[model samples]
Target: VESLGRDGLAMAKSLNMGNIFIRKKDSNSLVPNCEKHGVKAFSIEAGRALKLDYDYADKMVDGLLNFLRKVGILEGDEETIESQSVYTTKEIVPAPISGFFKPNATLGEKVKKKQRICQVTPFFKSRPKSVSAPVDGKLIYLRSEEVVSEGDSVAHIIR
Candidate 1:
């Protein structure tokens, strides 16, 4: 599992995308399910839901070709990938109330635990609740839309 994860990270680095290696596997995910049966597998999550990123698609093709060669599945010279940064999203910052969300921290920035990440003001003129980071980590995800419902995930922190 670790070997394939490193290769996946390498593929990401070779493609010039943000490199990530998720250390913990969820039992419901395909990779973990396959692992249970002694099958080596890795999953590639790319692009966005209901959207096709053409530029990323092209690079992914090249990266897959290189990966195939590296694994002896294809006959060609394989490219060596540089060391990559490994991180995992373990926590998500949720909106405290359905309201307009105002982010206090920028995405990709490192934040400390208990640092205020965003504020969600209630629609009925109530006091805004501050949403904070639960751990010291890099801000990995943030909602782009301003409006958020209570309990909706507004951001994620990966360490």
Candidate 2:
């Protein structure tokens, strides 16, 4: 169990997944494999470990479509992903002032620079002050139910 190599780790050896979905299965191998009387084939590359850009997502979709087409699992369009907003990571929005944040806008929302996207409470208090975007981009994530100690990522700008 502990001596398995990184590539040799098993996720699920089954004929079917049966409505169960497992994320981050590669990190823990034996935990994902359960039950008896079924085939055991591990899909090593099931998900991503880090944030993905539009290009990466497109490539992944294309690869999956091709694989499914080859195996006769899917018969449809060749999978065309059109990204409405594709921005480079170089255009990021940094925290102006660190504090307990409460996001006002949702992810993928187009925001302009200097527009209020979230607010920060000095000590998790009521009536928080707003934090504006430094660059025009889509908000990716907001620190959900987390305690940020200052300059710790309140929201992401994807311009």
Candidate 3:
């Protein structure tokens, strides 16, 4: 059961993207099949990008190796792999009215409460309505689509 992870969602490719959940019994069956074939498998959720941090990539590799060791595919001491905890309290900023969105904040940038995050200008109007952050947090993602409907999600903030 392969699926696009959170990175795909960050790219705006799919609406439902995150960790994949499997029933415990199903997972029990799946693990043995992978073990029999000497395959180590796991899932990860991350942001979308053309390039990734080298340090993060290395850590992922180390984590995979540790998983292999735990599942009997390899024999070694369990290596400690540190991972950054992801904050899940996300704020989905919605469009106040249908318009073309001009974002002021970049992805992964820190934002303060009440900061202007974007502006939405209706196609027929010259004035744009400014959107502000409701809480202090980091900008997790911004909508790639310029045109949006009223109440559509314009950006996501992680507090």
For lDDT, the strongest prediction is 1
Better of 1 and 2 by TM-score: 1
After superposition of all CA atoms, the RMSD between model 2 and the true structure is: 11.9
For each candidate in turn, the TM-score is 0.70, 0.47, 0.56
Candidate 1 per-residue C-alpha lDDT over 62-82 given as tens digits, one digit per residue, 9 for 90 to 100: 877877777778898787566
In the range 103-157, model 2's lDDT, one tens digit per residue, is 7788668788889887777664566677788888666556565355556667766
Candidate 3 minimal-lDDT segment of 10 residues: 11-20
For model 2, the local distance difference test gives 0.52
Enumerate residue pairs that collide in model 3.
none
Query: Which stretches in model 1 have alpha-carbon errors above 4 Å?
Result: 1-18, 36-39, 51-59
Clashing pairs in 1: none
For TM-score, the strongest prediction is 1
**Model 3 misplacement above 4 A:** 1-88
Q: Give the higher-TM-score candidate: 2 or 3.
A: 3
Instruction: Give the distance in Å from residue 81's predicted Cα in candidate 3 to where it truly belongs.
Output: 5.9
Tens digits of per-residue lDDT for model 3 on 1-159? 124355422322111222223222245566557856998443454545565767767755676666556555779865432333335367889999998999998987889999999999998999999999999988877887889999999888876
Clashes of each: 0, 3, 0
Residue 54's C-alpha lDDT in candidate 2? 70
